[model samples]
Target: MGSLWSQFSTPNPMFTEDDVAPQDSKVFRITGGYSGIGFELAKMLYRKKGRVYIAGRSDQKGQQGIKDIQHSASAEAFKPKEAKLHVLWNNVGVCQPPVGSASKQVIELQLATNCLGPFLFIRYQLLDHAH
Candidate 1:
């Protein structure tokens, strides 16, 4: 099927940072954005003038990520309560773990990280911020 072929095909990104228009007053939140792909995405969005917030378990790492984005984009921090979220990226996830592994709450680690955490984040946090 076309969808299946596309999955295995060489990645040809149809949209890049160049295509992103100036974001101005837009607000975005990304989980697990302190590192890896999420970090890069946060950087891109921030460069376009969007207010980017990175959320994770580690406050230290999150603060560092915010600093990194601000330094890279030469932008100032925006207050959370004043900004309505234009986008929320549930980018945090975990892969296979030890068979008996569980989250701090005793739920299965993968399920908690990939599903439950995002759900609660949206239900509790995103709702209040959504436009």
Candidate 2:
């Protein structure tokens, strides 16, 4: 038997817009993707023809995950969308002391990356960029 990691090392599968087309009634999720339950959830959604976007905190990892999905789709004889799958995952957060970092005195890194970064991404990227 293959190691558990090896067994799960396979990337999530992707489907074409036609095969897994978004019908204007799909839901999107964020955070906790690229591993664990989140990965499985994304896989299932993709398989069901939902417009699934995997968001996280690492660009390289996010891109790699997208590649894995494409590879899986190709291997499975499906035409995955080359540009349809959008990735909102990014690490704009900064390190700060535990608890109430946004209160009183805020660490610039923590505030900018953690609080403001995501806020901007959501407002500009997700909301404004919605198609």
Best by lDDT: 1
Go through the candidates in order and give the clash count of each: 0, 3
Give me the displacement of residue 91 in model 1, in angstroms: 0.6
Off by over 4 Å in 2: 1-29, 70-118
User: Candidate 1: misplaced stretches above 4 Å?
Assistant: 1-14, 128-131
Question: The CA-based lDDT of model 2 is what?
Answer: 0.57
Tens digits of per-residue lDDT, candidate 1, 1-131, equal 88888888867889989999999888888999999899999999889888888888899998898888888887666674644678889899988988989999999999999999999988887775564
Using TM-score, give the best candidate's number.
Answer: 1
In the range 1-131, model 2's lDDT, one tens digit per residue, is 45577677865546543465442335445454566666666665555555566777678877776676555543232333333434444433446556655533454556756677678678876676555
Tell me how far the alpha carbon of residue 105 in candidate 2 is from the true structure, in angstroms, after superposition.
12
